[model samples]
Target: MDLQLTNKTAFITGSTSGIGFAIAKALLTEGAVVIINGRSQKNIDSAVKQLQAFVPNGKVSGIAVDFKDPSAMDAVKQKIDQLDILINNVGIYASKSFDKTTTNEWHEMFEVNLMSSVKLSKYFLPKMKANNWGRIIFISSECAQLVPEDLIAYSATKAAIQALSRGLAQTTKGSNVSVNTLAPGSTLTESAQEYIKNQAIIEHRSEEDVADDFFKKVRTSSLLQRFTQPKEIADMAVFLASPLSSATNGAVIKVDGGSIPGIV
Candidate 1:
């Protein structure tokens, strides 16, 4: 389908690689102008080039912002005045035990995972409402529901994201603007691939075996029994960001491959 996204401007955070990058590419493929964000200019530039190569006529650019410093978003504000889509995809996490996790780590997780979306939505939601058309997508995770012992702080932030997205949608009532959260399961992004490779070598096992064991042991609830590809999550995000998803506001849509059990 066309998605009717031509010329729509989109901004995706933490898009240098992984799910965010996949979302960026998907939007660009649909003929949207995409501004991707990363921490360093070098990575941003490289990602922009790769995206352009993938979608030869794509209008793609980048902004370098470290969400750790809240003020860093001001740089982005100066460059763009409005947006048709704002995807809050930047996040950071550390898989450490609760007691072993430092106070600063918890703060960092909240800053990047939750506060960044809060700040960006605060800035752009009003503009979207004024224009009477927009889409705001928050990239949450199944971890919010399946809260693993080592990921308590991270899961807390993700849970907060669902609330944030829903509340923002309430403000867009009777308007074309929509705000929704997408909770993905364990996705096979670049870093995930690297982790599998390292574990395979360390355990003297095949990469496939290491990956399968992850689903069998660590993520025993996953019905798919494997890691989901980044594109799988990105496809749904592209739909949610488009005009076709006008009826989906305030909903926490799961693209979790049944990792999160239960019929919603």
Candidate 2:
């Protein structure tokens, strides 16, 4: 399983923590030259240091660019003319009732989750086409289909991602380049773990009990009956980034532990 990714360069957004960082680590393990991104210089530096410790001899770099700011991405564009792989992983979400969600919140969700990918692909996809080879992975979510009532805005953004991914994949028709989306379900990142712990305290129940109740009452359709680990999702992304996944263009691959419940 060489992955055939040695020396290939990759750029991932929001790589300072969580799923982004996990993907960066996996890519590095496969010998890819990885450039991580974050919103602040301090965070970027910290992530770079952490990654350097793990991939001592591997090439790792970082850039501070907030995708929400138009000007910030210009700086990012200047640093790299072309990329072998681009992972549009940066996103923001707010969980509130539709009546409580404001217009600004909707705009912010679309801006960061949807528009950022559109802009990045516009700039880099042509270069990929010219070279006749590249990989573009959009980190979508199971929410696109699940569409939780409290997460309408977030679900809308995720649905837009799937549509955009398919449209972009069409452009790569005869080329070696490929564009696809990876939709992951409830992954227990540090933040999620903290939230669950807080729920346990508030509900006067054990953490395991809280989790079990969640699967039974909230996510009853889930066959796995538990949260997925970040590394599990990262492994799928690593494979998608590699040359080994040549035929998977224009597809939505799910690492959602059977929570999505639909066969296609």
Candidate 3:
């Protein structure tokens, strides 16, 4: 179970909270030097402190960059020199009717979710290719396949990531570097828990009932019948980031709890 990740340096986007933060923690546990990122300095500092507490002797750092800003991304690129692992985990989403989604919203989601990864890979992939070793992981979503009506923009961004990841992997044909995408389903992060609680109150039902309804109605294809925990998704990410997963290139691995149907 040694992931063979000791001393490896990893940069995870949007790692101040939620699943990104969970993945950062998991990587650090495997002895990787982690760089956690967020849009705000406050959140980045707080996350660094929290991670330091968890890892103690482990190397942990932070970078605050808002990918939504082109100039800010340039700054971020300057700050990152070389990395053994690059995780494009930053993303934004908004749930609304297709008609209600504006062109600006679509652009914003695509900029933050898809373009940010493209820019990062453009800068770091060559460095990795030169070294002949690296791991590039994109955090996609099950909605890419499901294409939720209210999340058309978000789903499009996720689908774009799958294509981008595979195409990038092709460039590493005989190299040790690997690029892959992980599509996770509804995960019970703190924000998700809060959402469910609010929904339960609005519907005048118990939180358990709201969760049951999500699986029974909204997500009928799910086999797990509940939200996957952030740690569960993080475990898979950690494995994919390790040298042990060298053979798993140009693939879309699902940690979707059977929510995405059909066999790959």
Candidate 4:
């Protein structure tokens, strides 16, 4: 299980928390130099401390760049020239009906979710190609296939991610560099934790009851019948980012709880 990641350097966007944080920790654990990203210096500092403590003697650092502000990425470009793994994990979501979702919300969704990946890949992929070895991973979502009613915009961006990742992979042809996507189902990130807590209070039930109701009603197709832990999704990402996963280019691998139903 030596992922062969020693000395490899990885940059994971929005890594101050949730699945991104888990991925950073996983790579650090495997002896990778991990660069974490977040919005503010304070948050980035805190995450770095937590990660350092959690991953024994881990080489980790952070840069503050709010991906929501597209211009902020310019700062990121100046910090690093080459990367062994570039994971586009930064994203935002707004749950609203088509009529209720404002135009700006739609734009923001696309900008943050899809454009961030687009921008990062544009800068890093070519460098990776020149180096003749790298990994570009987009963290998409199962909603791309499920297309939940309230999450239309979010799902649209995720669907675009699949297409983008495939197209990018096509450019890698015979190179050791690879581009791929990993679609996670319902995961227990901070937002999800808040949702469960709020629902429990609103329904006068336990948090467990709220989670059970979510699986039974909202995400009825979930075979796992529970939220997947952030670490579980991170594990798949870690594997995909490693030199061991060279053969999985252009693939849209799902870590869903069987929520996305399709034979392929």
Counting clashing residue pairs in each candidate, in order, gives 0, 0, 0, 0
Candidate 2 Cα outliers beyond 4 Å, as residue runs: none
Whole-model alpha-carbon lDDT for candidate 2: 0.92
Ranking by TM-score: 1, 4, 3, 2
The TM-scores, one per candidate, come to: 0.99, 0.97, 0.98, 0.99
Query: What's model 4's overall lDDT?
Result: 0.94
- Positional deviation of residue 15's Cα in model 2 after best superposition, in angstroms: 1.1
Which candidate leads the pack in lDDT?
1
Candidate 1, poorest ten consecutive residues by summed lDDT: 70-79
Better of 3 and 4 by TM-score: 4
Off by over 4 Å in 4: none
Decoy 1 TM-score against native = 0.99
- Model 1 residue 158 lDDT score: 99
Worst 10 residues of 4 by lDDT: 65-74
- Over 90-201, each residue of candidate 2 has an lDDT whose tens digit, in order, gives 8889989999999999998898999989999999999999999999999999899999999999999999999999999998999999999999988888788998999999
- Residue pairs clashing, model 2: none
Candidate 3 lDDT (Cα, whole model)?
A: 0.94
